[model samples]
Target: MSKARDFILDIFMPTRCPCCEGFIKWDKLLCEECERALEPVDNSNEVPPAGCSAAVSAFKYDGAAKQGIYALKDGWGISFAVYTAPLLAEKLKGCGADLITCVPMAKRKANERGYNQAEVIAKELSKLMGIPYDGGLLTRRTTSMAQHDLETASERAEFAKTLYGIADGHSDITGKKLLLADDIHTTGATLSECAGRLLSMGASDIIAVTLCRTVKEK
Candidate 1:
């Protein structure tokens, strides 16, 4: 039934590559050219966010990966999340996460975008990894400036400190190992802030994962 439904959807709305916006085979995530252009990251030596036990990211935030993330953020290509989740899941194998959650957006911002892309990715990841997903595990405080608007890592980190809070019904995460998902990791400020909040709520540990991470210049 699922395959049949997908076939029908593909017939009417052919799946396009999120990065290039070019037609792609229904089962493919990216056009061959775009896939070839992506730079896979080696995050083995990367440090985790301040309060996270570990962290992993699939691709560097450039070229194809950046475009795909923008498409999902703008609500144009949500399948980007579906396709990217598997890559993150593979990297996160043996992470020991009991529950999966995402870096939340403010209600107003989420309503404006129609959905939170991070949540979409986290939910898909939960299905693939056989972990439970809790969409409301955290909430973002309304803010005047978006994280990207902050220029420096220090500025982003300071702004992020007041950005997140534990959701009302999820205050007690005692002993639960969490997987925190996000679309991008630039300076690690936001993920660190979110992980700190979870840890304060008694979460035993957190593993952070993102679809893309900004590559530092060599």
Candidate 2:
């Protein structure tokens, strides 16, 4: 039944490049123009959040990365995950993760959006890594404002905390290495708060992976 469903969906809904929808083939992530506009993130220049053991993003969040991310998050361009996840997974190769998980969204918000973009990307990452993904391991509360909506670091931090908790009766992660996924990393407040909650529940390590990381505002 699942195979049939996927086959039907594939026929009716073809994948398109989020950044250049009209200029790409089905298997391409982006057109030549959009690809050339991307500035890939360098590992040495990247910085992790307070509670994260490490962090990485596949591309610097600008130009094509910016357009692709928005299209995936708000424009039903989920196929962007197929092109983006492989790049992100390459960064996670050496990071010994016991399991994979995504920075989850609140139930209501996820319902409203039809899907969580982070979870979509995470699932693809898990497949590429041969890692297990447990999407139900965490829960969050919807916030009135997104991290991008907040101006100060303190405001973003406050909203990030108390929003996620280890799922009830599923808290046996002592000494386990966890890899958390998200669509973008800006202030890192959101992922840090999620890590804080898991570490308090006995998770030994947390590494964050995101599709893009924003350029710091000067």
Candidate 3:
């Protein structure tokens, strides 16, 4: 179970990078060069509210990171999750969360994709962080139009209401510090909507983390 053994095993198992499609080193989920290329989102200045003290993101949703996320989302490349989760975990240490919850896809998309990429990342991070993951605390009631295609923030947030946590009686989120994971954040509308829902559920704390955030154009 040495890192080198794992890397060799991974190569033989063919878990290559989705972007370059090259063999990834075992000790690193992705080649070190690629990791260095990713630009992490700096959230040091934003003063988040009580429940949402702050958020961290490992990369701007551009360049290699964008390519990696696209490959995973469009091509069903699961291997990308393996490498990306650690970067997220590193940003998340000491964030203070009791449980991990991911931004869920609408049932329609879930049925189509056969998986939720965010959920996959959250599960992987939960394992790495040794924290329990709560997959059922939220559920997407409906699918919204693709945010990328939309041009306005209001349109995006309006589209986001279709997503709602299934808060009937599955579990109580009250007083729990929750971490919400997503693949990308554009205008923060999507994350804000989900955070709003968590707050309504009486979630004591919420942290919005994403693998990447779409860099706004000037």
Best by the TM-score measure: 1
TM-score of each: 0.92, 0.88, 0.82
| Residues 78-184, model 1: lDDT tens digits | 87777678888998888788999999999898898999988888989988999999877788989778888889999999999888887887645789999999999
lDDT of model number 2 = 0.81
Model 1 spans > 4 angstroms off: none
Which parts of model 2 have CA positions greater than 4 angstroms off? 1-15
Q: Give the TM-score of candidate 3.
A: 0.82
Q: For residues 1-218, what per-residue lDDT tens digits would candidate 2 score against the true structure?
A: 26566556656776466876754554556777877787888866778987888898888888888888988888477766667898878877878898888888888888888999989988898899998887877888777767778798899898777678778777477898998899989889989988887788788999988888987755
Q: Backbone clashes per model, in order?
A: 0, 0, 1
lDDT winner among the candidates? 1
- Looking at candidate 1, the ten consecutive residues that score lowest on lDDT are 164-173
Where does the lowest 10-residue lDDT sum fall in candidate 3? 45-54
Clashing pairs in 2: none
Query: What TM-score does candidate 2 get on C-alpha atoms?
Result: 0.88
